[model samples]
Target: MSARLARARRLGALLLLAGTVQATPVHASADQPEFTVTGAPADRRDVITWGASADRMSNAVADRGYRLVVHTSVAGRDLRVRLSNAFGDRPVTFDSVYAGIQKAGAELVHGSNRPLTFDGARSVTVPAGGAVLTDPLPGRIPAATDLVVSIHSPDAAGPATGHWMAMQTSYATQGDHTAEEGADQWTEVLGSWFYLDAVTVRPLAGTGAVVALGDSITDGWQSSSDLNRRWPDYLARRLHAADADVQGVANEGISGNKILADGGGQSALKRLQRDVLSQSGVRTVFFFEGVNDIKAHTGVTAQDLIAGYRQVVERVHAAGKCVVGATVGPYKGWSEWDAAGEQVRQEVNAFIRDSGEFDAVTDLDHILRSPYDPERMLPALDSGDHLHPNDKGMQAMADAVDLNSLDCDSRSRTG
Candidate 1:
């Protein structure tokens, strides 16, 4: 057998033979010793490189370490991570946290793993329904890098808070193995991120980010996993190539999430502060939700959804952030298709397109609908479910967004 294949097989075997591994402590470097900072300037804010909306966690496991792989959107220095226990009924303690560069599967780039400190402490306890951010690790983090955040949770319970559809493959292991940089101990594969929700980095002056708030489509349900083909991912690529102030992108999409009600996760209204406004260096909110509410047949009328949209717009404006609204795309072939839902969708889309409430609007309905059948999705764009879009469709959606609209200034808001 080839040496590489042989090594992979051996690794696979070790992964299946799960056992407790002693945690390795990450020592602070002599030159770059970990320190704490209080009341940092808001202008030196950290922009979110990777974020997943927290929801009730499933498959909770105690005394486990997670090595999550996330892609950064903007390049900058001073990296940090945010851990959430938003849905947990009890406090979750994360004893060890490390940030590093991924070299390969479950492996770290040599000398890249750095210990993360929270308020100058190595350990932190996140209370139920709360979250905390780590002190920035002093260094430069380039854009589009495969950043690995290793976290060891000693006492995790209740519904472990995490985003259900990560679309990325992370690693996990029993016990506290967070400090290890090698792939040998990180044997178990984890499809979901636990405790860790967001990673942020301080970027260039005037650089800001836009948070994409939506449901399954924005959550990247049909996009290929581990490839980062979500629409927001594509939009980030565009922002990097273009001359725009909004270069950072945070996807706060939750599958089955709604703008009006709470079901799949906290409603967009409830999560707005935690997911959008609370993030550092967020300048704009890209609102693209409401299809679930319209199709759920839950007696949600057009006015009800419109009122919800108004609330979102007003709240976002109150935070002094631009709001980019996207009309709901067509979804006719799905089982929930009905004339009443279609009518409500039309009314809502009309309001989204004609209303002057939003700072900017992207007609996703016009972009995704079939030319022949307005109520159905474009077959070429659909991912066969006639609901979610494929990678190409995701790109199309990203392309539909106006880069200039994302960077609106205060004068533009009033104008």
Candidate 2:
């Protein structure tokens, strides 16, 4: 997809007069130098309030429509939706796309559903390993609201891409139901999010964002399903309450992801650019990975993980953003837990705390560890699996984070 199309082009005055199309909102890409949308005012810049990392997908049905439901983290207007074909083997064409507020179940709020366009056209084609951002809708999306993005692809197949573990209930149906506000025909229930990857909004100046990069725990494994109880979700709520400047939160965690190697998804090093740096208004990246690599018994040492962490920190610093390194949480009861892996985890956590390499440090290990036995996770917090945390534990991890470290104030001091 061309930038003019992938990144929604400005709606000219003539088009506005003709009422042929609405304005699409464009966000800064990794290659793009600014966070501000082209031709947009300086004060109202787009920031990523919600995002899900795109991963390899199966079951790409032809002539199918999906109504993906996602929760936003910040209050903002002129909302934009991003659709990805990142892992596709060929081009995919979307003839219709719509954005609206969820009323109940699969139904959308009356009169809130509106069609989205790509480059002043109703349809757009996304090439292999590319994405498209729809034009902005002229309205406000409140914080902690469920936003529905409906999309229809007439011929979509072959190695599609999306976040497989949405932890929310989305809907699917046959044919082009993108513009429908009623839930009558949307009968399929989907556990994973398809096609749609991100949602950005124009907010007041100085409002920033933080992206949490991690594994299954951060992916909301044991946290209650469909409740938005992920640690990052809790942190987003905190950001909105105490800090006005840094209010956006993007959870980029993929289940089974490793920091130094690729398995469930691209390794942290390989995906940093797209998942973290490319996101607009990202003042910091809260690094919370490496559990998979260490617990998998893959011959991954503490030094190997540290090298990867250093590379990530250098790249984030180069992009002029903060990296908040987190200590790996305890996983004593899990089958993969072993003395050698425990030793490696301790060494890595020590470096994360005392090395002074990261811009900020969030001692998650200190927070989640048991008082009686420091090497194991606290039983009250453990979700019975001992590796992942329950709702209470997830909230505890979010509370452990110093929200001040997530803003640019720390980055300013470090830089």
Candidate 3:
């Protein structure tokens, strides 16, 4: 073969390996004088360093304080917190809010606790179906740091919004103890995060984030508690160590979440804007969902699920961002498993693998499925249940993601 033809073949192979089609490049005129636009650099914007999916609260706790522990994904200054009343039926008042570094258990690092305000006011009342963001706290928070967020609701009632399976242990108190940095008053332990949904930080220019949108598996259902072993957590660590511009990760997974309907939480279609697009500095959306919809046997065909996926992709792309779709993993031994559901799962995975509708694809089904059965999860990776993955399986899923796929230029998509 000619040298030119060989080079073309090699390029085609590389693009195939990357799972993306090549776009034609635009060239500038060589005769034009290159005048540089010089001025003060633009201010850096806030990027989400940590987040949890919000779901309807099981019960309401009145006049209570919570000291939540969350792990940061990227380091930066001017930290901020977002509190949600998304599922509340009435107005909820959060009179006190504080942020600090966790030393151990409910104890905070000495002198690290700081008060937070909303629009210069110490207290804010979030209306039903609304949310509030605190003014930036002036300080640098390092990546992978254990940050503590304390909140006290004076007269909170009605439905509460929170993530039930946090996979981390946070503390709670009977009365207003958000001001205290000690663990003495925080005697009650909880496995969920309340009110607070996202934490943002102002990072340097070029820093970006990815949001993982999915169901119980993505929510770290079977993963160890307090270990930060969720697949997204692992992906965050990988991004921090790599040369990729996407260094932050926001996990938007709620247990029993569906792609088309509202059950455990608002459907992925309904919450896409508030949960994914509204996040700061999110360059790409990692879409890994649909198992619940399939297993629920809701008469949803592969076409229905594909339509939902297309809608999500279109919305994200319209926002000038890329999406990486993950194939649904196997769950043949799970209680809800049925041959008809499995058939739908197979059809959906086939589309995700071959359809090029997504900017990129991650074959999670190939990674998590048992080599022997091909329809069941690997026993070693399964956390006793056939559906959710354990820590090892979570790490495997994170490893399957190509780090380079997350770094998409927003201008390229828009232009």
Query: RMSD per prediction, one decimal?
Result: 12.6, 7.8, 10.3
* Tens digits of lDDT, candidate 2, 1-415: 2432322233121111111011233343343212211212222267788999878899598999999999999888888877878788888899999998899989999998999887678888887766777777788999998999999999998988899898999999999988889999899999999988778887655566788999888889889988999999999999888745678899999999988778988888777776676666677889999889999898999999999899889887766677899999998888999999999999999999999999889999999999998878899999999889899999999999887787544333233
lDDT of prediction 2: 0.81
Of the two candidates 1 and 3, the one with more favorable lDDT, higher being better, is 3
Return the clash pairs for model 2, or none. Answer: 24-135, 25-135, 25-136
- Deviation from native of the Cα of residue 199 in model 3, angstroms: 0.2
User: Among these predicted structures, which one has the highest TM-score?
Assistant: 2
True lDDT of residue 242, candidate 1: 78
Candidate 3 lDDT over residue span 65-184, tens digit each: 999999999888988888888778888899999999999999999999999988788898887766777878999999999999999998998889898888899999989888888999
lDDT per residue (tens digit) for residues 1-415 in model 1: 2542443343332222111010121122221112111222222346777788988877567898889999999888998788877788787888899999999989999999989987688998877767777777999999889999999987776688888888899998998887888999898887877777777787765567889999999999999998999999999999988746678899999999998888878889888877776677777889999999999999999999999999889877766678999999999999998999999999999999999999999999999999999999999999999889999999999999999888755323332
